[model samples]
Target: MPGPDYCDVDVLRRIRRRSLAALRADVEPVPPEVFAGFLPGWHEVGRLRGVDGVAAAVETLAGTPVAASALESLVLPARVVDYRPEYLDELTTSGEVVWIGAGASATGLEGWVALVPADAVADLAPDRRVEITELSQPARWILEIFAARPAGVGRFARELAPEVAARAGATAPPLPPPTPAEFAEAIWELAWAGFLSNDSLAPLRARLGGSAHPATLAAPATRATRATRAPRARSGLRSMRARRRIDAPSTTAPHLSGRWSLVPGAGEATARILGRSLALVDRDGVVLRGSVPEGLPGGFGSVYRVLARAEESGQVRRGYFVEGLGAAQFALPEAVERLRAAAAPAPGPPSGLVLAATDPAQAYGAALAWPEACGPGGHRPGRKIGACVALVAGRLVFYLERGGRSLLTFTTEPGVLAIAADALAEAIRAGRLGRITLTTIDGAAALTGAAATAALRGAGFVPHPRGLRLRGAMSRPESVSPAAETTAASGPGAGSGPGSGLESAGGCVDA
Candidate 1:
């Protein structure tokens, strides 16, 4: 682990893996005994009191509010999604609240979202719809415009074309004028691409030729609209739109909404994009080009230079941290600090950590390579949202693919697989993943394999005709499975608890 200010990327990698798993660890913090006894009677019961409350308990939910997914509050942090699931459900699709566009694949604004107050819309509303990214061509062409100027969103591009042409030294005509239909189509592309947007879904509703919201759509086909890729160039605008359904919110909604402005910073557009790139690299702690969206105007070279300058300024550091990520890696100095001090194999048995395969913690396919698949010719598991991964001591142990039908075991070790299986059962019992009905493991029928059966039964899975079924936390009994029943018969310290069955393979942490 000796590596200087930063741990050797090997050690750092292990630390980061565990950190990602713990980023959303399911735990409730409790005060120490000293404070608890010192402040006796501090516990207060009331109707959602503020932090100013005399007791320790405060700012808790006394009731429900609208959310897109019912599990949002129970399982995730606030504002994790731009707006909660279906947050815009009740609002008029064409009124003050609006839907903007999404970034072209991986720009800086992928997960980040913007919101504005109701009255702010009067000043922020687009008079002519913003369409700067495309018209500007190479962003540097009109550096002087975006440099230190918050170009009004409502301003017309036609009005600014002359300055752009003169600045870029272009001898050609100012710009071509498009037919009405062509103009409308171009605007839509920019809107969805997130260069410009408005509060009203009216335009988008018109385009989808039906309900503005995907949830309201009659067909499930459009559910994957965002999966469609729009080309990176302006020339493809017309064909791209005509080629697909272009469902407003489906493809990209719940983006920069309510109120927003273009040209966010007080510097050249390229510089702003570069700075945003640095900010992203800085925020992510450790980042390589693939993880950051700093490749548009100047590509990775620009980002590299900015990071290099930051390195010189002592604002950041550079290294060939992780192998295969190239030498241009940059990380916050504190990240190195954490990398040095953070990880150690815990004293007891390694607990399994279960998170969505796509969760930042499941770095297997991205930061690191996935272990060779156990089954011959078995397709590598995809790191998708619906799929889940189980980890022990920063190493991947299992992958439960979408729909919980296939389980991909990363390890053949009986001990780790048993712990992972018990972790899955704990996840189901906690209602974290709801009921899990897995049909297969390692490409074999779920129940046919001796290893799979022992693991599942140890974790509480019961038989289903198609495969094996485990009830969700809400529907299940106090005990988990036949194995738990046997353990319970042995008395306390055996298997009375939610995750107690893992004792057969050492032990397990409640994932």
Candidate 2:
């Protein structure tokens, strides 16, 4: 008979976890080559890593795609103690694969990123890199400056920092910089825009320099340290104040001054990008067209035909695998098996999980419609940074907005809310939920309703003047300015913001 109807809460939860490799146990480490083979989709580069983004590390190595940090893991001697050198050496050269941004935008941060294998890359008659035509003037100017004189990224950051700063005098300087974490972000954008490319990712695997001091060479960590700390201190590869594009490099930023060379890119690169997107679909097993991300490729429309071909070839199966979407879903035979296998209930009552709202495993906003908002004000959730959803036993309980201050209840069931609250609290206690200080729930005071208060308290939270909070994450006073708060849970916590009390307390803001 046909497989289980395939539209149930258990199937959703299991598939989500399976897609993200968030099963009770951790996924075993796979070589980069093998890992890239099953690459799911481009990860929106930023601090959003848990169960979302491309990857935090390949060791989690499940569905999350490779990231710069993951790339670094394969290189850094300090971090490589866990894996065999040969396993890590798979991509040692620039030839095996190439990392490029989806070219979603020349400015937007949603430049989904991924690494494509060399053979698929070579399939394009011209090339596979995503093409960019909407490049911002500033990014174009910066590219010109660098093109004229290829200097270190640090030097470019330093030069552009002042110019960008002067322009910001008109307003608040747009997205203020000195953000060193974005150094890799800028490289990501440039790579996608076709301004920065190398035959291999070798530049990241090894440090590069020209006329550098012996002391600077001796301390690679020092340069990276300064780069990371520069947003507050002011030095090292600074992100552009305007945010999406960069012009100059900050002083002292080292390791990538002259290593990565510039490239012209293919005239029309959609074929390669589309090919890779389909490749990811096969590897990922089950894929929704929307899951590929908009604007990553230059064009579309041939997906059904391609899937039909694959089906005829016995390469993939097409069916109503997921609920709440059009009937155009496709899955590999193995993916269907795994997804059905995932239908079984977990041995224990679900502990609950808080993962990135955009995490691919979450089918609500992507493959299915978001649950109805239960409270007064209508709530719509997006796959945004710092935004998260809490689930208990595959049921979406609540959605946390970006700042983490406001929350939307997906289910009004008091019992479900209680378990969800407990899960959130447990995650916080274990430091896995990140630091959240809920100010509002269902648009009302998060601690206002009796049920909410009971849920909060039952889950180990305390009634704070702000709303509800866990002592471990919220008790400590914050020192950073309101403007510097970030949304990456793996980063720091929020400090202050625009509202009164908890509203201004940097709700849901990641460090």
Candidate-wise lDDT, in order: 0.43, 0.46
lDDT of 2 by residue, 187-227 (tens): 54565554665544334333311100001112122234332
Clash totals, every prediction: 3, 24
- Candidate 1: residue 7 Cα off by (Å): 33
Q: Tens digits of per-residue lDDT for model 1 on 416-437?
A: 7788888778766665555555
Q: Please tell me which predicted candidate would have the highest TM-score against the true structure.
A: 2
Model 2, CA-based lDDT = 0.46
The superposed Cα distance between candidate 1 and the true structure at residue 315, in angstroms, equals 1.2
Reference-based TM-score of each model: 0.48, 0.56
Predicted structure 1: clash tally: 3
What local lDDT does model 2 show for residue 259?
38
Task: Kindly report which residue stretches of model 1 are placed more than 4 angstroms away from their true locations once superposed.
Answer: 1-268, 293-299, 323-325, 474-511
lDDT of 2 at 8: 85
